[model samples]
Target: MAKIENGRKSVDTRSIRTISSSHIDDESSLGSDSEINGFTSDRQTDKYGFIGGAQQYSEESAQDVPTEVLRQREVKWLDMLSHWDKWMVKRHNKVRLRCQKGIPPALRGRAWLYLSGGKVKREQNQGKFQELDSQAGDPKWLDVIEKDLHRQFPFHEMFVSRGGHGQQDLFRVLKAYTLYRPEEGYCQAQAPIAAVLLMHMPAEDAFWGLVQICEKYLPGYYSPGLEAIQLDGEILFALLRRVSPIAYRHLEKHKIDPILYMTEWFMCAFSRTLPWASVLRVWDMFLCDGVKIIFRVGLVLLKSMLGTREKLKACQGLYETMELLRAIDARYMQEGFLVREILELPVTAREVEREHHSQVKRWKKIRGELNFKSPPRMHGARFIMLAEPPRRQDLQQNPTIVVEASQPTPQLKKSKEEKSKKKKSVKKKQPIEEIPNPYPLLSDPPPPPKEPPAPPPVSSEMPQIPQQTLIDSPQQEHPPPTDLSLAKESPLQQSTQSLSSTEQDTYL
Candidate 1:
């Protein structure tokens, strides 16, 4: 009968739950008081209650430039925030460019919250997240969520240790998601992305921000099958071929798969792949621009690593190619320069639309042929291309058409099985020795044929005691099959002679 105030309305939190007797974990008592205070040590407590990270602000660590320049940018951002509604409508281009430059860490959280519509969503879905947090999550997804918490940002100060404030908050956020969107459940990628979000905002704000991201920015991405990620990889490859043909050719020649490098880049929204500074900058643009930022960032990294002829020549094999791509020069990945390159790239919304349509069709066709609803077995593993020629058609007129290779007919499989049976029957009649023995030195008999289940009286474990039965009950075990003609050909004639009888009866 607890009264909960949500926006203008007062509602009982207990009314949302089915069971009255269910025990709800006290959300407030999950973390230690010191760790709780530590999480908001960076931000002004009077201004932001419990929604920010423990990011310390020294004069030196404030910005990447002089205080004066940082102050000017901060002023512009403040003005923008003041007139956020009007500026978002009228000066979107200006807002986008400013975001590309990088949001100051002091104002970054608010900017991301505003850009991602977290604030509005929070107000609209008031107390919904708190209700979700109170419910116990599915054990299936909770275990997976627990496993991925430490794996999210192992080096980040907040998430560095297990059972810390950061880890506890991360667990609550992800667990709430599994309860909120039960169909989507908990995805491995969502953990790192949610951890990044929690670094900027409180659990409630982060939950809403994550909702906007999973639904608006990355729809159909973190579902059970992960169809969006696979389709995007195909689209990215197509864009790569158009944007940097030479680099594309080098990758194709080396068999460097898109899956190898692109999985974490797209799945975690580049949180795991890029440098910290660049990662924050990218996150800013990613929140504003949607998934295109992801494709552009991916293209930039690939083009930088493989774009140069000298770089391509230096990579001798798959391992070298992976190493070069994995280890991008930090100097080159500076936020200012990298964002500029990404913005300048020729990738467009219309082009992505075209590619998406084509790739989706291709995906459906392949799925139909292979009957593969889930991601491929080794979709995350890197594979070397063993010298396949790169296709160089202009994407404008002749987009790559992915025709699904027809599967082998059932008749063909049946014919093959019939042929194998005939071979075995022929081998069985060729009098054991006259036939060329595949294993001449080995005397083990062929394995028994698989048959339908028999009566329950026959024991399944009797096969292991074959030799003991032969010695113990020699007279009773079919009288050694009066085969005088075949007995002289082999030393183990009795055992070999009884092989057929043993297989025919289930008791044997």
Candidate 2:
């Protein structure tokens, strides 16, 4: 191969070969072979592009980002910062020099495509997507997504109606996304984010936007092979500590895991909690800001709930705890105040992002050094029904049915052999010793059952309501599940109870 001084590709045609088979030198056979070769010339031949040429074109196109447009962008950015001081303005200007300015909401789709530096990512992703699309429209998709369809945005109106377009698109995007990423497959919160996108944009554009989120924003949140979300959760909580010290301290005090509240936030891009108006507004920043706002918004929500969290400590019951989250609305009364406060926080979006990245680096450093061992007893799906043995009969006479205390797993065969050996060893010895490696570690105790307080010793003095009014009293306190409580009462009923954040974090 000879080098080209001008950096042009030097194609060596000597390596190119044409097929000419058949030992026949007969005139008719030669003519037929020639005819076949002539037909081959009409078919398309693969052409290769020069890497050097591509680079040259890229540089030239990058350089041609019109000077006038760039100047206007600078002006627009400067105009938005008119309220800021000189120092902040200069810092903003410096950052904008490298990063592109955020696109207006009207042009979000095109802008997101360009900003993500994925001009051809769509075409490539779509090709992979088309291969998966052939397997779509399965009945299982509706059943699977339906189970989680309401679960994702329990508080939202758009996904309230399962057969609604809002939810229908949400399901399609999730199903398509799952089909595309079979390794990660379907996760819990993606449908909510898709619903959020469908609220403002068409389904296809929203689908592409979801593709960008899965690829760029929330990198490994859904992958079974990757535990990045669990790892990043630590970093997010740390940011919460800095941003909302009181809430962080409360979580520390109570053992409330951030995963209880913020898991949905990180997984769904705040679609689970934030109001639609605020969610759409935050999404504008989220696309440009990546997942930084998720952390910030978490801090903001925690701060907003400061008053409510304190009130929560006074509440003595499970119903009361759920009532707090179910009734809490971050936008107007609950989160809106915190959002306003967060916008005024001393940290810049860039600084917060830098801190988030630094924290991630720290997490990676620790993950390498530390052994994150999961508890042995933790398993999925299978739940035990604790039934007590009948005590009426004597131990010898009892129709005793012993429940197999140990659940079978893939590792059960080896465990069974070990158990048999232990039995033999015990039988051979006069003195029996406690077995050390008996089974997977004892399971965590289940939450205590909620038993209605023994009906207060019937007070004959208390007047019972007439049958008609009797029905109305409980109805007033807790409405039919159909009439969703959008105001103050609604969220409380829908909320799930969690351990105090403080305890959860310390243990986590």
Indicate which candidate wins on TM-score: 1
lDDT of each: 0.65, 0.46
Q: Model 2: residues >4 Å from true position, as ranges?
A: 1-120, 123-131, 137-143, 149-168, 307-326, 329-339, 347-508
- Lowest lDDT sum, 10 consecutive residues, model 1, at 377-386
lDDT of 2 by residue, 1-508 (tens): 5333223222211211111222223322533221322222233221111121221222222213365776765565444333222322245434333233333343444444433323234443545545554555455554676566545443233433323444556766777777766656766667766766665555655676676677666666766633556655666677767777766676666666555556766787765565443454455555544566566666666566653556547534544444554455524323334345545655454655566567557856876632332212101001000111112121111122767677678688888999999999887864433322211112333333443222223245543222322222122223222211212222222121112222333443
